[model samples]
Target: MNQSVFQKAMNEIHSRRLHASAENERRFQEINTVIPELAEINFQMAQTASRILHGEKIDKIRQQNLQAQRYARQLLVTHGYPEDYLDMHYTCPYCQDTGYFQGRYCTCLEKEIASLSVETLNRNTQLQLRSFDQFSLEYYRGLTKSNTKGETVDCYAKMKKTLDYCIQYARNFTAHAPSLLLYGEVGVGKTHLSLSIVTEVLRQGYEVIYDSVGNLTSQIEQEHFNREKSDINTLKLLLDAELLVMDDLGTEFQTSFTDSVIYNLINTRLNRNLPTIISTNLTPGKLEEQYDERIMSRLCAVYQVWELMGEDIRMLKMKERRSSQYL
Candidate 1:
């Protein structure tokens, strides 16, 4: 919990409180102008406290206040308005948008803090550039591959199914959605599809982090060693995000620190039953070799593994550009 992130969340809560108050005042004024009797009732209701201070019997004043409130509500309903239309409507009724209740921080405030933290962490990534619509299956057209079951599969058909699956996965994503292991050779759209899922999941208002494993590991290493001046608890954020997407899994600089960090992150998230999406160029065997049995066992047991197949779409696009330039 960084101080700046907490302050930002508090500021948002203050803004919501102010908006609710302003809107309530506006509604009261409008009703006062439209119905003069409501103004009189409101005046009487406002005088209850002063009347009690001036030696009026507390029960009598309280009764008068309740009667005034009932009359006001009746007036509102008779005039085609809800009884609570003039009440201050808060975005969160629990805290009245003040961000605290019962001497503790409200759940709404905690959620805001979490959302803001994810936003801060993802500020550097280009999450907007990738989408499912931009992913094409044309690159796999007329290609064929043999599956593990010793059956010939049409690459285009297989990839089309993969594309559809990714789209539906994004569209119907939830916090409890199954974790994913997207493994394939370079430029087979592993990054693209994973990013596509990330964009949609984010739009659906889940906290998602998308970054390369190498970059994230570097940041974690820096924060862990106090080599960088950052207040954010990077490892905690990664573990707690609603959906964590780590790309290029095996490309990070290997060290004891990175290995421990990666293993802890995976194990913690799995224990918490949170969803994570990992894209890697390494096959299952290579991944086991790169990490160890502990990491591979968890991934194989829980993750929905998808093996993307195709030639390098980047190379195909480059050739297309060159041919167009010649023409």
Candidate 2:
């Protein structure tokens, strides 16, 4: 993980602590309105403790402190308040918002760092601009049937179904949700829909790891092989994320390492029943040919496959812009 990202996480933890402390003080002030002597007793105890810390072992100081606490408790109970109500309310009591427990990083801090680090790494993508509501269905209107080669493949209906399924999938995503295999040609909104799911799943507070197959493989190779210089836990984050979305599956460099890594990752996710979303340009035949029968069988048997077909929406948008310019 990046050092700066870790620093941000630390800052967040400290900020929480500061806020809790301030709120606790405010609560105490509010309580003082009802029990003025309780606040005075607390102030006296603070002064006594300060003097004790400074080596002034005054006789009966400890007894006086205990008596003050007992009186405060009795008053609180009589007023229908919990004895310990004045204590700071921390979100994570394990670390008390300090991000560490017994000199070790707390689980809350680790999870926060992982989330921040992953988002930092994925910030290069244009995912923020792509959302289900923003995806225009107008482009798929004219070419309802037949693909680019004039094949009679009812492209429009398939595209519409794909869009609906993706939107629904995002709305009801769970850890055990069915894995998705989205295959089609370029610019058919596969990436857009996948990213839309990412946004929704994230909004629902689930961890999602979305990366192109090319970048995923490249990062794995760099970190796994070059262990000495690598600090990012790339593979761990991918495998542990609630949902993994690999866009443009077959665009990655073809190598023995890449093939094995992909197979292992997919197979592991399947074994664990973890949901994954894979979008590729390769047809079923091509996918089988490229990754062999094992991967194909797993995908076909376990994944909810969708084949989206439409003209390249990117080109359509470009043409529309040019036409508007001429107008």
- The most accurate candidate by lDDT is 1
lDDT of 1 by residue, 227-267 (tens): 54664777888999999999999999998888888889889
Candidate 2, 1-327: lDDT as tens digits? 556777898999999999999999998998889889888988898898678878976787888888988988888888899888787889789999999999999999988888886786677554563688898888886544433344666566767778899989999888999999998889988888998899899899888888898998898888877847544678877877889999898899989888878888788998888999999999877898888577788888989988788889999999999999998
Q: TM-score of the candidate numbered 1?
A: 0.88
Clashing residue pairs found in predicted model 2: none
Candidate 1 residue 9 Cα shift, in angstroms, is: 1.6
Model 1 regions more than 4 Å off = 141-154, 227-231
Error of 1 at 177 (Å): 2.2
Name the regions of candidate 2 deviating beyond 4 angstroms.
29-34, 47-70, 77-82, 141-152, 227-230, 317-327
Indicate the residue-level lDDT of 182 in model 2: 90
